[model samples]
Target: MGERSDGDVVLAACDLVVAGIDGPGVSALAGVSLRRPWDEIQPLLGDALLELGLDHHEHNSNEGKALGLRLMARRTLAGELSARELAAWVHDRFGHGLPAAEELARLDDEYDILEYDDRATTDVDEQVMAEVRRITS
Candidate 1:
């Protein structure tokens, strides 16, 4: 669900794999819902995959990448955040198994808004709102 494999794939193909995994739903935009914390999320994946009878190894990579990005984004935004930080946040979220440089490059290639500009001011709240709009709509 996190990895943008293409434009059309919204959720993971493995239905059983995500069964019981508390993730972001449509209500995420309303800011009234809670999602599985990373600490809770990381451990459950193994069991979920096992229960689903799927290859845990194949999916674990993207899970880790997505978790790392979420962590980084939370930390960066909690402090002085910028567009570069936002881009880095998105890169880490989507990068998955790709190299760091490659991940950043992919972000650059995919979206014009992720570009880091020194001229821009850092505003975590505003940037987050912008990001939410960008991703959701």
Candidate 2:
């Protein structure tokens, strides 16, 4: 793969965070309440970036890109994009050839299951649930 844009790296990092939270088995966000604090989540983001081969030395040296990624993550956590939307973004950017795209597809399935379970118990907004259903179904 060519060099990923800063924005692409940040979005991938966001995907990693969501996947870590919602993937099967135990997770840090598993028993948490509705509001997930960034402090608790930021480390996971850093780990995700590292796993994707982002160099810590480069990240530390490039303060601007690092700050941009942080802002992007904040926006992601703030619900600027829904799970489906994020998946689509990754799909469009990376296509099916990349490992990250495949992993994102798997994560999309996990997201669907979690959303289904959440919708079963709580009164999740109909529009949001419907969109998720439409995308996942």
RMSD of 1: 13.3
lDDT of 2: 0.43
**How high is the CA lDDT of each candidate model?**
0.43, 0.43
- lDDT of each residue in 1-137, candidate 2, tens digit only: 12354444445444555776333212333332234443344344454445556544333244433333334334444678654555555455444544424544445445457655644422323333343444343
For the record, the alpha-carbon RMSD of candidate 2 to the native fold, in angstroms, is 16.8
Off by over 4 Å in 2: 1-74, 107-137
Tell me the spans in candidate 1 whose CA falls farther than 4 Å from its real position. Answer: 1-60, 89-129, 132-137
Candidate 2 clashing pairs, residues 3+ apart or interchain: none
- How does residue 97 of candidate 1 score in lDDT? 48
lDDT of 1: 0.43
* Clashes per model (N, Cα, C within 3 A): 0, 0
